[model samples]
Target: MERDRGRYVPGGRESAHQADYLELFFDLVLVFALNGLVNRIVPALTTDDLNVRWAALFQTVVLALPLLWLWTTTGHITSRFDPRRRLIQLVVLISALGLLIMGTSLPYAFSGRGLAFALPYVLLQAGRPLLFIFTLPVGDAVRALYLRSAIWFAGSAVLWIGGALTTEWRRVVLWTSAVAVDLIGARLNWPVRGLARLPASAWAVERGRHLPERYQQLLLIALGETVLALGISYTNEPATTETTIGLLTAYLTTVLLWRVYYHRSGEMLGEALDSVRGRNNLGRITGAAHIVMVFGIVATAIGYKLVQQHALDRPFPLWVVVILGGPALFLWGRIRLERVVFDRLSRRRVVAIVALAVLMVPLAFTSALVAAIAASVVLFGVAAADARRSAGRPPEAPAPPA
Candidate 1:
């Protein structure tokens, strides 16, 4: 493939390292693994069993740490190194294997399955950082970034191993601390040198087309996971007319959320991140913002599952509130990130946020299903307005090749 050198422009092409297909595939695997774990856990939530909820939550938190860490590091590395290289391929494959092990350990992380889960996760968490520390050449600033990152990874590995050997609650606490430290440390350290300095060549390697493509693909994976959650819930229940409508509403809400993300603000946000002075700020804005967005997505998916289960039978006022309100939070982050508010709030989004809030009052007195449907409609409206507004403006053009 002829390299499009133009795609290497600063603030225009930092995303160049993202491998869309590979990222999508990786996310797909993660979704399946997560879904498997969720399937095991959701039943406990429905039963109102506190023990089950705690166990499931512990498992989810433990399993999520390594996967998210890997995801963040993978994008960072891929942005810096050419994915087409043989050495990079080997590293990615090894990382993938580690991720697979982490994903598989979800259900067992906190339960009687402790050893089964913790061991592989230890391997996965430690593998990439170790590999990058040793294999990547010195002198390059990127090497320094990895070396710093490896410090956090090593700390996390110690906690993981310590957690694995401990009693139940202590295990959760240890692993949580490990993940928390890694997360906070990365924010404090990793992007400091290269991203802060913003050398044109390094910036080109970090923010070009590949990175944006990876971000876009990952967002899709998140949306797809939401859809999958909805499908699973809808299929398991007895399908009635109300259930069908509720399912459709939930699905439409997901679609609208996806539209708002991809159509309205994704590219512009990418451009903005690229234009930022340091890779550190870019990493903070793009990398950190996406993590927040994904959390909202995961919350929305959980909300969707709740909606599908209750939409026909016993939709609670809270369920209605969460389903509609969740997307608003997601879009709010996007709007904040884009700095596009006050330009013109889409009539639909305004309605969605307001309508959902308004409906919640009546929902307190009436049917849960009524509240859910209203909230869904309002969210869809908000997403549509945002999408239209984004579509109207042209994305910032890519800069000239350096």
Candidate 2:
């Protein structure tokens, strides 16, 4: 079969070019900005004022949806389109601006000023898909994917716009429904004109390094944001020796988590993904692993906040359990993907689980900050050791050329 050069160029060596570090750096800036805004707003939700609490929750979900969408969309586009292109850079710039607007509008969205937030967000949300649709010379199959994506974006925009017009709970419901529609459409394999069919070729040989690097970088930014939140919280509170140690422990935990992930697992997953021959499984695994990783990170952030709030006033054993458990869950989730232990328990994973269980006891007795950080490190350390042991063995050659 002849390769279509115009739509699909082949023979690009899957070299491990260093990830576009600059792109990631810019993304981190946006992430930190947004995180700062969220840290400011979320605490109000727990305040004694019921109105503030309700308003905070409303604004948080409203802002969070667009932020999540932007990250996911940019990561997807960057994976497929060459970020070095002028057009792509412009789209990224617009998205960044949209993020800035979204960040600024968070405190105001629930006070019937949502349109101020929603309009820019819609622009950011719509711009990337539209740009990619017109610019990237993708084949019919991939174009179909974009079209479906566009429909989802349109639906989401409608809900977002509607939410801005009215502060009623119904608008929130509508926006949520729109998000659901997009999610379900993708899950159900709903087709769009010109791009419903999944192209095995587009993804099969496409560079895995690019996408995985984006994933890793985003995770790092999320961790950094959490640490920033911890710092701010610690500074505002009375600084005691315990608080100081807790703060340092929180930072160490974040560092150890990074070391374990990058050192032990990231490269292995990248190599495994690159070696795969088709796009479907690789995309699914990549997507799933990423979700689990981010979920864990977000959970850790929440845990960090909880630890900071409770460190001086209350015993936070449960919060401690959560912070430590968050990363353990993340690591275990990754291990499940790596070892293909979908339905059955693998020996190594069982051992990892047992290690986690052992850590839980200490976690129950320590400060939330200490326990959470210690647990994350322990989980990462176990996984790293396991990965190293596996790496040392020689590969068995293909059996005598069959």
> Which model scores highest in lDDT?
1
**Whole-model Cα lDDT of every candidate shown, in order:** 0.60, 0.60
Off by over 4 Å in 1: 1-20, 50-62, 190-205, 313-325, 340-368, 387-402
Model 1: per-residue lDDT, tens digit, 163-252?
888888899888788778777776666444444422322123264556656666767777788888878888888888867886887777
Per-residue error (Å), model 1, residue 121: 3.8
Q: After superposition, how far is residue 170 of candidate 1 from its true place, in Å?
A: 1.4
Lowest lDDT sum, 10 consecutive residues, model 2, at 393-402
Judged by lDDT against the true structure, how good is candidate 2?
0.60
